[model samples]
Target: MDVQEAVFLALDLTGTFVFAVSGVLLAARRGFDITGGLVLGLMTGIGGGMIRDVLLDRVPNALGQPIYLAPPLIATLLIYLIGKHVSRARIWIVTFDAIGLAIFSVTGTTIALGAEANYPAALLMGALTACGGGLMRDAVASEDPAIFIGTDLYLIPALFGAGLTILAEVTGLLGGVVSLVIAAAAFGFRMLAWKLQWRVPQPMRQWSYRETGRRMKKLPSVFRKPD
Candidate 1:
């Protein structure tokens, strides 16, 4: 295969493994059976790519290539065989998820650009590709996803990766090396965010009557009047 094809394959494999581990960890946490674990693993591995392809108006790559599915299947088996034997499942889950996010963000941007999509669309596609699998996994596992909660810096890394890819393309530096560097930078950012407990701050909305009443007594006249 050529360099581009090889890069794509690497991204696919890396994403598959990361997402598979995420699914497996969730299944283990929920005490799912082996079959359930396998199903979740498969969904997590290909869910994002499937969504990306559908949005891009193409057949899903995972469906067309056995390579895309096999690594995840192997991962499922490994998780099943080792089931909670060596280390903390949560740590594994987070590590794999971070890797998957980085890989998918870069790969999705590359694919979108290859399809001749505009920069904004490419960035959106990349973010979706990074988060879609985790969304599916959370929905299947009946848990709230971090994206909506603003608890984790999940989407930021994806955005950074996508933005970097677009910047690289605009600057005429979008080769495999540059792409990989961008992906790695995104991954590093995510790791740092996780370590630092980075969070997207939620905006404070206007206080409701109850809150207003509670605090109104303490405020000066200028600020106390209702709209």
Candidate 2:
């Protein structure tokens, strides 16, 4: 592979490795056994890429390259061995996960673009590659997926990274540096959200029962209305 391809492959593998580590750590925190950690880690590491490949009508990279499976298993083994001493594993889950997510966003978008996908499809594949694995991991673990179930900055930053990749690819400018910047920005955004405990706004009014009752009192009761 040329330098660009080599660089992207390294980034993709790094993402897989870190995502596996995050999954294993989370499994440890959830009281899962080593085997469970292994399962979750493997799922989290390669699930997104597999899903993206299938959606794109291509062979899953992990399937063809069995070596890709090693990272998650190795990560699980490491976490199981030293998880107790690493009291900060729980907190580090977010950090590792964020980094993995950012890298996956860039890698996925790059792959999709290389496959001749349009910008929109490339953007979507980027998100899938960043999130599909986590979704699978959470479902297997019987927990909520952090990206969609909460106001976490995960999906937003991933989308931004994907969008940036598309823009750079289209313009043929900063093609090499774009992925790096996108990954870094995405990581920073995710870390800041976690640090600030930021949340996405929803349609929730957040009125307490007392407030609801007060508001109700202002309206005429049906009993007092003409029957």
Candidate 3:
């Protein structure tokens, strides 16, 4: 592989390892056994890329090349062996997850652009590739996925990085340094959001049984007309 390609691959693997660590840590925190931790780690490391590949109508790199599986496996085993000694597991999980999110955002957008996808499609792919893994991990663990629940500004940082990557690529400014800067910016933004507890706005009107009942009471009056 060329040097540029090699660098991206290295970044991708780094992201995979960090994401795996996040998932394994989460499993440990939730009282899962080693087997469960391994399963969750693998899902969180590779599920996003698999989803991206499927969307792009290509074979998943993780499945097509066995080497793609190594980082997650290593991470799972390492965490399983030393989990008891790890303090501040939650903080570590969030930090690692943010790193993975940032790296994957860049790599995914690059891959989509290479596939000849348009800008919007590339952006969507990038966000998905960063997020799908964590969603899968949460699903397996039976927890509400953080991205959808408005727990923090998760997807926004991914999008911000992806957007910057796209801008750089289109402007012919994309390089190792640029990519690293974009990823770092994204990571910083995510961490900032976490520290601030920033959240996406909820629906202006929340629907609930009580609201529905109140509306129903008004509904009959509208049907009765001019009594």
Candidate 4:
């Protein structure tokens, strides 16, 4: 493989391990069995990339290559071995997840642009790749994914990372050193957001009386017209 391909593979492996650890921790919190934990871990590691590949019209590397699956399996085993002895599994999981998000955001943006996608589509792909695994994990665990809830700056870092990659590509600076710097900046922003408890405001809508009445009227259509 060429240098770029090698770098891509390395990033994929690192992201997979990070995501897998996050999933394993969630599984432990939910009291899942060992098999369930492994399944969840594997899903978390490969889920985002699978989505990105499907969108980009390519076969997911995670399925075609053993290297992609092996890291998560190893991570699952490690988490299992450590079990509860790890004093700060949650903190470590969050840290790794942020790093993975940063890496995958850049990777997704680069891949999308390499496939000749438009800037907007490439940015969307990066956001999806960065946040998709966490969304799936939250869904499986019966929790709302933070990305959708505006609970944190989860999507912001991904956007920044993708933007940087896109800018670099446009400026003819899509080199390894530039990409690494962009990824580091993205990860640093994420860490800062976490440390500062940065959150987007969730606006609550006030229901109009007319709107409430319309909803009330519609609700009785299948209940004998409410007598």
Residue 172, candidate 3: how far off, in angstroms? 0.5
Model 1 lDDT on a 0 to 1 scale? 0.84
TM-score for each of the candidates: 0.87, 0.87, 0.89, 0.86
Instruction: Pick out the ten consecutive residues of candidate 4 with the lowest summed lDDT.
Output: 203-212
Model 2 regions lying over 4 Å from their true place: 204-227
1-227 per-residue lDDT for model 2 (tens digits): 78887788788888999999989988998899998899899999999999999888888889988878988988988888888898887578888889889999999988888888888999999999998888888888887778764556678888988888888887886455677888998888888987887887653444344546544335467689575
Candidate lDDT values, in order: 0.84, 0.85, 0.90, 0.83
Q: lDDT order of candidates, best first?
A: 3, 2, 1, 4
The residue pairs in collision within model 1 are none
User: Runs in model 4 with CA error above 4 Å?
Assistant: 206-227
Better of 1 and 2 by lDDT: 2
Leading candidate by TM-score:
3
Which ten residues in a row are the worst by lDDT in model 1? 203-212
Q: Mark the regions of model 3 whose C-alpha exceeds 4 Å error after superposition.
A: 206-227
RMSD of each: 5.4, 5.1, 4.8, 4.2
Candidate 1's C-alpha runs over 4 A off are: 206-227
